[model samples]
Target: MDIHGTIKIDELKKPYFVWFEENWIHDDVLHHHQKGQLVYVESGFQYITIEEKIYLLPQNHAVWIPPNAVHKTNSHSEKIKLMIMFADISTQESFYYEVNVFSVPPVLKEMIKYAEKWSKQMTVNHNENLFLKALFNELPQFVEHSLTLHISLPKDKRLAKVIQHLHNHYRNEIKMEDLSDTAHLSFRTLERIFKKETGLTLSKYQQMLRIIKSLEYLSSGNLTISETAYEVGYKSVQAYTRSFQSVMQFRPTDFIKTIQ
Candidate 1:
């Protein structure tokens, strides 16, 4: 959804704007706006590129885009549902300065969905405006308490191939030798370069990718915990729970409850 068309969001007189889009498809063109933006995913995942870095936005999560930050979002799936907000209020807090992707608590998610009634603008000093302000005020606390499930992509061609291999084979057992061969580098060289490019160890990055994939499985509502764990390459539910908690700060069962 590009706000750069004839209807510029910054020109609106309201202090806040909210839009809930269903089965949405984005233009994927790089664009930015004057007001800070918050995008929450109700279903399906979105890939958001900010400043040349791509972040994964899974279901039941939200991403914050700072004011005037060049960003673009894309989703190949046609079932994506998004709750978007444009806020004109001043936010000098550190978290508001850069893009962040964090899990949305059930309460905050409900509050945001409740705002679907008012789309573009809400009258000032009215109940709708007050409700939206309360919802926005509650976001920072949730962000502080929740872990940001950071999933980023590499730009280097060799590393990009390695990343693709990992993405395609995350459900199976992959070894360092295989990854090294995929990258066409020595094991040690691949390790050093992968860490340097992604700021994450290869093992950690792979585990994060697996867990993110597992989120997709669980959100579908057709998989049991054991089924989802097995789909993500976990030999046992215990191991899967540990890895999921390490990345999400919550257990798989807890996340399932959120979706239910």
Candidate 2:
């Protein structure tokens, strides 16, 4: 998927820089940089893989990549618009040390949009740099809006088989003993390895995967809320809504409004 052979910018040496990319299409190879990156999807979506986990960045959301974090990304939508900011963070707070995906608040969204006008390396005392500093300082407060949308793939070969099976049958009922048999491990051993590798229990991981897949289904506009709930394996709309709210921190109707 080399729609663009390479989109290059000298971001590593610059203290701060901004790049506005429209309809970006690249399946980037695994790479890392010394600068922290903030990629906001103005429209469409992008998928980022970090530490064997896949994170979906939908419209009106952003993903923060800490300096030196190993990852790769790809976006399929021709309508995609991205505002990417790179900053040197040697003296920054500890908050910038982690990877996160969160909904872009209205204020931060506007700030990022406004930042599109300046597309080159910024000097320390430049007016744009001051605004960028302010944006970074206020980001910790917004981290509370982080979403639980990442899907983890275990490194263990046997556990990975179970994860693949879960993804293929997420819309149907699953049994633990069945997964254990498929993994060729005892039930307790299978669960233990899975939890250790993914940091989530099997049930919790399944619930999260269902909710993440439902986002794509809901955004496609062919399914109503109740239909989407049932499509993702929920027995009732109320149960689905509860799970959605727990993971996304918003109701399904509210999310629909943002995309529409």
Which of the numbered candidates is closest to the native, going by highest lDDT?
2
Q: Which segments of model 2 are wrong by more than 4 Å? A: 1-12, 74-78, 120-125, 220-222, 257-260
Q: Worst 10-residue stretch by lDDT in candidate 2?
A: 1-10
The regions of model 1 sitting more than 4 angstroms off are 1-7, 10-13, 52-54, 76-78, 122-131
Q: Please list the C-alpha lDDT of all candidates, in the order they appear.
A: 0.78, 0.79
Among residues 3 or more apart in sequence or in different chains, the pairs in candidate 2 whose N, CA or C atoms overlap within 3 Å are none
Q: Can you write out model 2's per-residue Cα lDDT over 120-225, one digit (the tens) per residue?
A: 5444447877888788767788777677779777888888778888888888889867899889999999889989999998888889889987887776667899
Give the TM-scores of the predictions, in the order they appear. Answer: 0.84, 0.87
Model 1: colliding residue pairs: none
- Measured by TM-score, the strongest candidate is 2
Native-structure RMSD, model 1: 2.9
